[model samples]
Target: MTADQSVTEPVAATGAATMVDVAIVGGGLAGSLAAAVLARAGHRVTLIDKRAVYPDEFRVEKIGGPQLEMFRKLGFIRGLESVACPYDRVLNIREGKLVDVSVGQAYGLPYADLVAMARGQIPDASSLIVDEVTAISCSDDVQQLELASGRRLKARLVVLATGMAGALGYKLGIKRRVLAAGHSVSFGFTIARRDGAPFDFNALTCYGERTADGVDYLSLFPVQAGMRANLFMFRDPADPVMRDLRRDTEATLLRLLPGLRPYLGDFHVTDRVQNWVMDLSVVEGHLQDGVVLIGDAFQTNCPAAGTGVARLLVDVERLCTEYAPRWLMTEGMGKAKISEFYSDRDKIAADQQSLKMAHFRQALTSRNDIGWDVRRRLHFLRRSLTHRVDQMRPGWLAQVRSALRA
Candidate 1:
């Protein structure tokens, strides 16, 4: 466990109500990380969740880029390194030809492990309670919660990180306005060669050949089990091809992307097929008294765009480190104070960028107009050309670009 330095002393919810400075109502990534951050800062924090441990969910299994930087800043990079499978290179291809190569640090692990890692960082493990928050009564000064186990909790403020489970938020007049329902479909499972040898590439990404297929891309990366694959598509959930992909994964994948056959080299799925139909949504009327929302609880992201972690990190950083602490110093937790987080420049930018990337990926994969066709070609061509130039010049181009910016 990455959080071995921290203790795991469970806080039992007893007969009477417990009081804390802050109470977070979700034990997932955002809530857990917030609890750890606040508790480490010597705040009286309580984190409540229905499940004691996060299940092996097929969601956001990889973390990299600015997400890694945020984890480092929040003091979770060591823990992440302890549990994640690290890889630094990804070979990008299209139509069986090389497009480019991406070089950066990334980690692959199950979503459950990531949550556990974050939860373990709480300085006082007893601050975490395993229970469901049935109802909440919010005010400017104090927030009260009713638990399913018949216990109560009172706090100065509340953090709603319940994710796509919006029933609790709905009760508080917080509603999710769906931007796109069934926006995309994603499949996750492990794969290994039939002969049991390792794959040649460290990581690989294969883009769709034609727009009609609605196949965005197939990403193969390393995980603890083996090579993990995440296939993203913009097709309808009820499409028969979805069944084919689930039942005859390898064959159907080859049929849709014949170019992938040579790279795969007689591979077979090593685990049960897990998939999700994503919806692009944002919570409206969330700026309420005594509470604020973060992560998927605020807005959901397109898995194909790979912006979920980035947005959530911005939320956690702004809320826990900046807004929450500052607000706690003052008197009340009214909508006037909570609205600052929603209007933060960085948080708003991240949210908008996630939506923009969602549309861009969908159009890049499925748009059949002449403009997009030309764009798709130019996109791959530009990347390929840049990769070639970088391969020849090594760090020279980067240095020149940096100097130019200066």
Candidate 2:
């Protein structure tokens, strides 16, 4: 689940009720962090998640750049350090030729550490409820929930951090559209000798049309020689590329990197793979009169940036600071203010994602075709020409152009 896209289905009547300051739905990175932030502010928080613990092994292996800054500010730096794969380079490869490296300052850390750090920033784990929310209702002063066991919680405010498919967003009657841009995929993981993998510790690799059949993709974060680094590559189930990943991931990888095939020193799979649907669209507005959507609820960026956790924490950082605990408890910021904040943050994220995707789309659509054709060599040259994107790069304007086209 990338955002608070889940909803509580309407349930049978129940009478029990408990009061809380904030009700947090979903237990993923965003929901958990929101629980911590609000708890630190002294708000009584009741978190309801379907699961009792974090998924033991995750496919999202690293966090870098602005997200690292957000982690440090939120006090997750040590947690991130404990399980991190530090990397500074991000390599871009089209067909077999090198294209460009996205030059950005900042380091990458492990996903588990970032999640733990954010969760640790809050008061305690005992406060949250590890159960399902069957129904929810909101009004001027109170927001309510009904547990599957018939218990109810009424809070002063409800924060929806459920990722895509979480119940509350659907209940809120927010506008939503199913995204078709990317397919669901899993990352294969294992550690290699420092010399075994020749990847730069600071760089991530980007492949234009990662599959000869056509699929947009990027590989990120290289851990130290002894530590585990993730390999994220997948084909849309509906696309022709699915036959390769589902049947033979290893064989597919070998085909992709012929030079690195001999370097697999005792490499083997260790855990069940983790995967999720990738939605590359934004929900129009994330605020309604009685509820406010945060993180993936508003918009989900492409995995190419690999900044899902960073973007979620960015939401927490802004909301916890701007609204202030004292203000939310009193008169409430109302629907208008909440919607404005969601829109502002959504624009920043969407604009950044828009820029990266534009370059990615062009690179993906033609890299392989042109790489094989010397006469039609325009595709490979086009990618190399516009290699990086940042506030300093001219590509920012290119992004603006694409958004208008969209």
Candidate 3:
């Protein structure tokens, strides 16, 4: 029987637990997608979460680049497109002047909607157990989970896809090592013109003008309701500017990014300013028997760097597609089997690249050192020059790049 079709219900009074091939401990994008993948593979899978519908949260709202390829490989690109508002062009600007136009496919949507789309992919309605996972006991043979409803689950393997919630993992002796505390802050809000006119551009990106501002960049993209704005920064969360930005968003934005004034004519923040402070971290002591940590449960990524989704996609793809199924066919779930996922070349590369990009974005935005000053200048200059070249001779740059690869 398929995983979704053969859900074993919890037995009554005597407290007998349901047995499955895999139990996913979070219904976020990672857990839900992993559940869908494993269930489709014919493995008995149970996805446990506290809520039936994901709440409106400020997380990865836009995804593009290699993420599309990964989604296509996993056969979810079409589903993703259905829920997302697609855009193909981005007007990039720096200090009120044009930088370069980025031409590629990207998508924007509410994180809740994205999570719901992933959860809907599970064919078995009963496979998703809407309950809190109170505690977990793991071993080489089988893993047992105690739910808040007094029901229990016994699975051959436990996939810890819990994003940033460490209580359950803590009970299992899995601890997060904070690599950088208060690494960055992100603000999300919708914007619209006072006259109710459409924006001049489909999507826009405004880079920070001054280093002291600690502002990295402001990204404006289309969502279902209105134009969504994401302001990323490296400033202290306790700063008075933060309060001003939240209370007087438009005024503070214009003051900080005066160049944006001409581009955005008579606009106002149309919704509550949702903000998040991120701490870059990774799980320690996670390598154990019967349980595996994936996504933000294993490492936290900077929103400005935009690597959280990439890292999680790599984890799900590698674990669900490669390691998990192969391990299940063997005798037991142990450290040796679990280590294969953590050590997978692709997984390790994604994790390392995420950390690297986090540091790079923070430095490029706020570092005013002589060395960084030159690097930052050349970074923009290089892009500007390339744009000019491509504009003058269309398709020339692409041909040169292709030849270089050859």
Candidate 4:
């Protein structure tokens, strides 16, 4: 995958040939959304990913909130409307005590639905090659890409949306090699019986505890009407308690779901359990010269935070909206302008993830910490202040309207 040592062949333009405005790597959620945005904006986009369609993915499900609005904007949210199971309320159980509960009957949409919608938005791409990006080279004027099937491409911009590809990015000198294998982990497991669970599917369930070592957080909610619910447990790898969670899942659930025993009574382990590690670090930097990183490649946040997909989608949407199309439409949109646009977005996407991570960590680890007490007190104060402000009833969306207008 060396820049100059590429095994590429000239790809004849299937029809009238034109250079691709943007070349995106790895057609996962991140790459797919970026391609859709650019293509719909009338930019010639070539997207390459190695995977077979709808490959077996580990991220089983997720909760939806303000992010649904983002899905709507991307035009990928429609298909999910039917398959997405609705469970809006969140319950927080801490160290054998029910501490906080948000019962809003909110909805939960699966990752499958989200991806389906994003893919649906752009029905076709200039060259949606089902190949991997074997090589990438970029400079002030043009971006070069080498495909696994030996195709060479030139574009105004090349985006390295490949997930956690350190070797690839480092070889291109796009980023200094850094070990980001973090200790924060989220493991998903399933139980056999769920129909009679003492709890209703209308509310989501979460349990958290902060030990002397670190944090442990669990999320439980129904995925579909007849199908069983899923249990997502997140723990810091550095914490000793997490080492044995897989062996002690039943006991852990027993402790957390005592009230739901009536519903869980008939369930026995009938499915093979599966889990994957989560990284908690953000990309050190977002861009350099010819290449840019998006999605998990940029900021691999804690999954419990569930902001990875949302932030990634927003990044592509904003970039395609404010930058990509205009670049292709004009004759002189060059490296200087592209560089500035990418630099600004890189900082913003990374910072937004940092802020969200802070709130998530504070909430999920406060059970046995003095800092948690501070977090709760401050959160309550903020809520109180917000309530008072709402009483004033400013009908004006102007504060934001003016910024958007500007």
Candidate 5:
């Protein structure tokens, strides 16, 4: 059915359940995007979220690399560009010295704005139901959802894109398997120069000086408000340093990342220091009938690895563009059909790569063993040397690297 023909129109008079092809629980990035894609594809889609307007929440505030490609493929590139602050270069440094320069396209913005843009993609207003999902019942033929508003929805398939909020899934007997508890801590805040002058660099990334410090890196990029700073570390959340970072943010930051002082040049935190302690996890007992999980609803990623957006995009693209349409075309939304998406090669790879990168970043940041020490040094050296070579002969290094890949 067309998006203009909302299931709500039919069910309001009868006070019966709205029958939809897909009932997406959560209007976050994954759910909103899925609803848009499915609705535009002429499927009857109902997107339910507790919030009509996504609040300003700290999340993956910057996106680049393969994520841009996915947005382009999903026809949201222009929309993303409209709401984001774009930059094409990044200054990479280590211990107050330039390690290399990363030249690529990236966008930075508040996570709420990103979700808002995604929600705006939906064709019809009625597709979004600003209500909470209190209970869910699933089976092979159809799935039922009971909203806190007393409205009910029945769908051929349910896409649980509720993100890291796992309570709803827990009710369905789905449990998260915590691979690493208290895995990483991330801090997000806005920063600006004291003199109110624009910073010299387009974007900047400063690596940790000492392994024991447990700092992974500090990434500074442009957003609509000002420069956004994301600090990722593999450290104890209860440490006094965490308190200092929140209380005495500017001083504590410079103390931890000394090299940053020179680049920042007397900056201050322009907003509250928002911090999060993330656990590395993936869901267990989720291979059930009638429903499938996507995005953080499926697995969590370390912020330092910068793989969260990539993994979620893989889930949305694979499930919406491929499996969901196919599943809806067939007989029933059974466990057999749901398993197809879980077993998808690209989805599996993205999920696995997110976990792999998470471990890699933790080890590279905190491990002081001789093996890791040597590897870490070599890693920076290889990047520094490659940058120098590329600077000496701009196109030469790229050509050699391309040939090696071939």
Candidate 6:
């Protein structure tokens, strides 16, 4: 199959139409990965997106822990390594003192590069269509998509991976119910030392000092550009400090996190300051016929909790690798089939965990109640003590703990 170079008028009166086993509406990480997995499984898949190339967007910039395992299981780990900067250690600090160290292999890259890497996994380049899905009509047997270019796509199933683009889903009567509007704010920017010297730490995480500040933590990790910083906050979006952070990032960051000053050593932002005010939401009225919603189309995550990628990975894995193939083998794409994916044990766990973590992070960061205040201090103390013990015994304590678990 050859790629469609451009979106043109329909080849036939009903507008040029192509048939596929699955039609994916968005080409973000989830959509692209699903397309790659299904296509590799020998399914005729069509991936459509508004942009030919994903733009530099302030979204999930790193994939680690279980997310890495999922990527490897899906056969995209090599593709990830090719485009991302890998780091295995993160120095975690609080109030200018070491709290703990996270030791794990992780990859940092622009979100667009990650999406491109997933798309590249598809052997047939022509399987991806660069066009806009203006509308969709889904039924139990066949699903149809109308493109802005008058091209039409028909498939047995439709996967809506249109991350946070509620417009398309709204047209289908799917509505996003806001769980928490403006749940958190996230800032993404690159940083470099003033003297152009390398930093001592491969990756660093600096937690906020005070609950009043509404700051969660500042995560500095390596990317292709340089040291990339992601500042997650529970503060109001209209706060004057937000503007200051965008205009005078280096200085404002120091002011918010004074302990960060000595570690950064006269650094400045190297690129455009990108920030997002995320709303925790889930789509309602979506458990319908012939269609499945994944990723942000199903629900949005709190950046502070760092669960977005994990949730979406579960969506793609459970839907594409398991439910989707089984559904395809059956007669129709009915609500009963769609509900199984929605109610899948792993998918539900991931989504619920995301919401639970979101609330936990917010409470830990800004809640001033007596119980939370005590919990906050104990949290850091426990981490610090664990780190100290680990430094003394190396892997001995971990091995002992693992043995105890067994």
TM-score of each: 0.96, 0.73, 0.97, 0.75, 0.96, 0.97
Report the lDDT tens digits of candidate 4 across residue range 71-169: 677666665566677665665554444445554443544455555555566658335666666666767677777665556778877777777766667
Error of 2 at 247 (Å): 3.7
Which scores higher on TM-score, 2 or 5? 5
Q: Which stretches of candidate 5 lie above 4 Å from their native place?
A: 1-14
CA lDDT scores, all candidates in order: 0.91, 0.59, 0.92, 0.59, 0.91, 0.92
**Model 6 lDDT per residue over 235-318, tens place:** 999999999999999889999999987799989999999999999999899988999999999999999898999999999999
Clashing pairs in 5: none
Ten-residue stretch with the least lDDT total in model 6: 1-10
RMSD of each: 3.7, 7.3, 3.6, 6.3, 3.7, 2.5
- Writing each residue's lDDT as its tens digit, candidate 5 over 36-138 gives 9899889999998877788888897998987999999998999999999999999999999999999889999999999999889889988888777888999
Error of 6 at 306 (Å): 1.1
TM-score of 6: 0.97
Clashing pairs in 3: none
Candidate achieving higher lDDT, 1 or 4: 1
Question: Residue by residue across 1-406, what tens digits does model 3's lDDT show?
Answer: 0112133344343588889999999999999999998998999999988777788999989989889999889878988999999999999999999999999999999999999888888889789887778889999889988876668889999999989999999999999999999999999999999999999999999999999999999999999989999999999989999999999999999999999999999999998899999999999999999999999999999999989999999999999999999998988998889999999999999999999999999999999999999999999999999999999999999999999999
Estimate the lDDT of model 1.
0.91
Mark the regions of model 2 whose C-alpha exceeds 4 Å error after superposition.
1-16, 57-59, 88-113, 179-186, 191-235, 262-267, 284-286, 324-326, 345-406
Residue-level error in angstroms, candidate 4, position 76: 2.4
| Global Cα lDDT for candidate 5 | 0.91
